[model samples]
Target: MAKGKVGKTVESLGDYLREQRVASRLSLRQLAELAGVSNPYLSQIERGLRKPSAEVLQQIAKALRISAEQLYIRAGILSPDDGVGGSVELAILGDTGLTERQKQSLLDVYASFLALNAVSDAEFAADGDVAAEPVATDPPADTQDQDPQKITTEG
Candidate 1:
């Protein structure tokens, strides 16, 4: 598949899955065989005729060797979380043991975190006119043998 500029706009979950399957050179029947789902079912999923449950999504993801969360993200079901935390509602939804209430709680938290982080990002940009560029950090010569940090303890 051609790499598109807008990943979010370019792919529905089904479209992404179809692309991956095609890139892997697997036919629908082959993917269904590997995924242990019916060919028709997989086809419907690719056509966006159905919304896969988390369990089904996980099964497909496993066959594709990807995280179930990634499938949901591509499907536009969940947005990524922000802040210093590498987390989002999809992380919570991926947990099979969580009750409905727990999932709601996690989603609420993630949404709030995203909102707060958006504001923080705006503030940070406003603070400096510095263009964001890759800073060249030259490693010291023969640095491989040294401990990463000379002092581990904080002052």
Candidate 2:
């Protein structure tokens, strides 16, 4: 990405973070304390003077009771498409009942399923059947010439 675009993304992320903090009714110092960061650092982040790391974003998201993926996307750390199954991941991560090992196992299985589906979709597209099939977007040429009143319903 261009330097200008990166700067804008960081600035937007900071704006978003500040909005969330305000919406959550938390003071800057309170949010900084909750996120385990210094007050000055949080202020710098809110002002778009600093681009925080993924870990810091995660901490801030947790403190704000929001999805970390949203922050990651705003921070340009992850693309929107990359967060396709984010809700599932978030659910697994947020489940306090599950042990760390169980969460990891579930995440691994989910990732494998997504990977397998992606490969299957790619293979299907590459098989030439897609190109050979007619796209059913428009009526057939014969149907286009037919009168609607003359058409019979089999049902």
Candidate 3:
């Protein structure tokens, strides 16, 4: 990614974090405490002065009760396409210059799509066809070491 995009992503993530913090009614100090980061660092993030790694963003997401991918999208680390939609959100993120807030709103609303799936995760995993698949096991290797030269055609 270009430096400009990186800068924008950092600023956008910071902005989104600040918005989420406010929306959750969490003070900077409180959010920092929950995210396991320092208050000053959180402030720096909100001010776009520092770029956080995916792990840090995930921690912040956990603190905010949102998916880590959401934070990743805002951070410009992972594209929004990586969201649950599998590629749908990517197109939306691309081909349109939607603001981070708008994108986040769309993602939040889209998250409800889980309710529309034909089968729940447990049900899908329990399908008969899926259950019929063979399970792999580690096989014992031949422990004997034979000399290649000694293996000549011995009648």
| Every model's TM-score | 0.54, 0.54, 0.51
Worst 10-residue lDDT window, candidate 2: 76-85
For 1-155, candidate 2 gives per-residue lDDT tens digits of 55687789889998999999999999999999999999999999998889886668879999999989889778765556645647776676667798767866887787788789999989998885566566567677767978988988788
lDDT of each: 0.73, 0.83, 0.74
Kindly list the per-residue Cα lDDT of model 3 for residues 1-120, writing each as its tens digit.
Answer: 556876888888888998999999999999999999999999999998898855577689889998776776677644554445445555444425776567656755655564445358
Q: Write the per-residue lDDT of candidate 1 for residues 34-151, one digit (tens) a residue.
A: 8889999999888867666656777888888777777866654465543333355656777789975687677767678778988999998888987777898767776756788773
What is the RMSD, in Å, between candidate 2 and the native fold over all Cα? 11.9
Candidates sorted on TM-score, descending: 2, 1, 3
Q: Which stretches of candidate 3 lie over 4 Å from their true place?
A: 1-3, 82-155
Name the runs in model 2 displaced over 4 angstroms.
Answer: 1-3, 86-155
- What lDDT would candidate 3 get against the real structure? 0.74
CA displacement after TM-score superposition, residue 148 of candidate 2 (Å)? 62
Residue 152 CA error for candidate 3 (Å)? 47
